[model samples]
Target chain A: MTNENAITVKNLTKTFGDFTAVDAISFEVGKGEVFGFLGANGAGKTTAMKMLIGISKPTKGEANVAGFDVRTQAEDIKKSIGYMSQRFSLYNDLTIKENIVFFGGIYGLKKSVIKAKSKNLIDELGLHDEADKLVGSLPLGWKQKVSFSVALLHDPKIIFLDEPTGGVDPITRRQFWEMIYREANNGKTIFVTTHYMDEAEYCDRVSIMVAGKIEALDTPKNLKEKYKVDSMNKVFLKLARNIE
Target chain B: MSISIKNISKSYGKVKALTDISFDIKQGELFGLIGPDGAGKTTLFRILTTLLFPDKGEATVADYDIIKDYKDIRSHAGYMPGRFSLYQDLTVAENLTFFATIFGTTIEENYDLIKDIYMQIEPFKNRRAGKLSGGMKQKLALSCALIHKPKVLFLDEPTTGVDPVSRKEFWEMLKRLQKKDITILVSTPYMDEAELCDRIALITDGEILQVDTPQAIMQAFPKTIYKVRTSETYRLIKDLKTYPKTHSAYPFGEYLHFTSTDENLDPEELIHFLEQKKHTQIEVEKIDASIEDTFMELTHTREVNAHD
Candidate 1:
């Protein structure tokens, strides 16, 4: 295992009865690299991500995340990585400050550390005025931003974001990418999945999953040249049109 | 007009869902309401479809008053809510039949209307709606919505979380349906999809920002956009935002789309500024604004005006 690699997977596979969700996929992400994982709906990207995050065990193969064995040290891997998804990330009913405190505690941070971190997080987000307000009252963009900050409260080595900008406006979406870039610049490995093809171009490297296999994996520039396309959207359309 | 909304306002308790929303959709025109979540799209749709009444203002669907001719509007409008509202327990065929029957029509009566969309899901006709994949479920929902051959179709973010490929296919379907003389009013959070509509209304925070053809909106962009590229995107964006003349700087794909507050901004001066910052592999060129650029500018200016 290379010390510079944050995540390593080798011929990982997961099956349900007769259905093969993720088929013998192999990939490696280096530390501090922004990796974009993309696929069509039901293309096994979620299954592959679940295995990498140490929640769902692979039916066959070996994988490592954050210097821990995925199968054996699943609990440790969970503790070492941060995850935020569009569907479930924060408690809407809880105030912003309370949600931060609760997530900080869940990450096993000391009370004093949590208090200091929450203050910094609120100030950084310019949400000091809305700290005591329920998270549900905040706009969708603000909620997504706050949830992302909460995910980083523990300062995990690698963070996984699932469709973080699914329905965000163009400006907020770019702001979210800026946040991702800042985290990457600070030496944090970012694993992200998004349906936005333009966003796929923002990643250091991207892998496109088809059915249950990775059909293409390369930098956006290389992928564009290889596919003879001008933009990532065309590359995606050409790749996805193959099945139909 | 196929649908018309005048000063439509709706509020839930203290939160104004839709404020002074007004738009008109011509017969057989494919119109889009483009906005993010919580932008009052669904509330406006509900009012237009006669399912809910607006606190103030008047609307008509298929030339029938929304309030007085509610039953007529209900019959003339086909609504596909954002969330799949089909019966999960029923099979694909049964769900279509149920919708057809409720409209006092039969599948055979409107078979031609949904043939293109229905055929795609016919193979899974016996499968339960709950067991269908995301794409399949969308197709089924769309088919059910069209069972009664509505005059005006209201699709509320039908492709919200759908993949790019499926989203493309869905838009193609709408285009074909539009050719059948049905007025379509669809809403989507994706700015890119706005181009597919004959006309679009950019709505945000319960207010309509702009309404025009996608091309016109881009052409009307008030600032000269510059595509700035360099080795360090993050640093370039940070520096560009801090520049005194910076109007708006947002990351677009691999490069940053920057606009200067000074009209007739010189690219050479910007290049020289970056050169002074010790940046390499720099490229700066004037580029046309896109729909997204226009949308961001409108919302940004709106925020600034609100603060003032």
Candidate 2:
């Protein structure tokens, strides 16, 4: 478990019944890096993330997330990493601030700290006027931002964003990446999965998963060069189509 | 075939969905209504298709007032919703036929228009629509939408969940359809798809941010662009932002698409500075701005304007 690598996965595999959702795959994400986990729908990106986060079990593999063995130290790994699923997990009935407070309280933040953090998060997101507004009343982009900020409330070492920018506008997606960059600057690792190839270009290094395998791994530019494609979209298409 | 919207506004209960949104679609033009989810694209489409009436303002699709000539408008306009709302249990052929029947036409009447698309999925036409792949479903949906030989078509994010190849195919079909003198107004969140449109209106939060040809939008980008590539491109992007002349720096593929406040700044100076910082394999070159870049600039400029 080295400090340089925020996540170390070796021959990781996950099976559901008889089908292997995540085949033998190995990859590493450096500390404070935004690692893009890219794949098509049901391409095992989510399954791999689930295993690393310790909620789902791996059939056969070895992994360390934030220097904690995912198998024996599931609790420690969970405590040290923040996760925002593709689905909006915040309670729609609660106020924006209330959702933050609720998540913060669960993470064992002090009441005063939660309050101050909520205020800061709201202001930073330009949602100061909407702090008292119900989470359901906000737009999808705002909800995504709030969900992201809440994921950072516990100050976890690694944050996993599963298609966090899904259905968001290009402007909001840019803003969301800014927030992720800020967190990365603060030395937090970001592991994100997205179907958007343009968004994948923003990551430090991206791993393209196809048919439950890590078919390509490199900086977006290198992958493009390797695939002899101008765009990441083309690189993905080449790899995905080749695998098929 | 011209469509115009004047001072259109709509609300759902207390929520203002759209406000004074005005735009036009020229005949045989591939117009794009670009926006995110809940950006009132569907609302506007519904109003123009005669499914929902706007709270205020007037709209005409293909020279017929949406309100006064709802029946005529309905007959001449084809709409594909954001969600695949076709009958799931129905076979692909059945769905297409049903839509054709609803429009008082049979598949054979307009078979030539959808023949290219329909032929791709003709083998699986007997398969249930729900059991088809995303790409197949897209083709089937487009075929169903075109079954009536409509003069104008409104596709609400037709390529949202489809694969990259399917998206490309769908756009090609739209281009082929445009040859028939059909006015097309399509909405999508994918910025890349915006370039495929003849003209696009970038919308956000119930307001139209910018409207122009994709080329025009790119040309309007108010900054000199540089593509900065290096060994640690990600780190370079972060470090470049701290440079005094940097206005905006974001990772674009293996390079950083950076805009500098000082457009006259030399690339040699940047390379030297990176060299001084012990950066490796650095390459800086002036490059063209993309539609996404233009969209970001427009949105940011609008936000700054609103704040002011």
DockQ of each: 0.88, 0.40
Q: What share of the true interface contacts does candidate 2 keep?
A: 0.43
Chain B TM-score (each prediction, in order):
0.99, 0.93
**Model 1 misses residue A170 by how many Å?**
1.4
Docking class of 2: acceptable
Q: Where is the poorest 10-residue window by lDDT in model 2 chain B? A: B160-169
Q: Which stretches of candidate 1 lie above 4 Å from their native place?
A: A1-3
Best by DockQ: 1
Q: Which candidate is the best by TM-score?
A: 1
Fnat, 2 decimals, each candidate? 0.88, 0.43
Q: What is candidate 2's lDDT per residue for B242-297, written digit by digit as tens?
A: 78888777666556788878878888888888898889988889898888787777
**Candidate 1 residue lDDT tens string, A1-244:** 1259999999999999999999999999999999999999999999999999999999999899999999999999989999999999799999999999999999999999999999899989999899999999988999999999999999999999999998888888999899999999999999999999999989999999999999999999999999999989899999989865
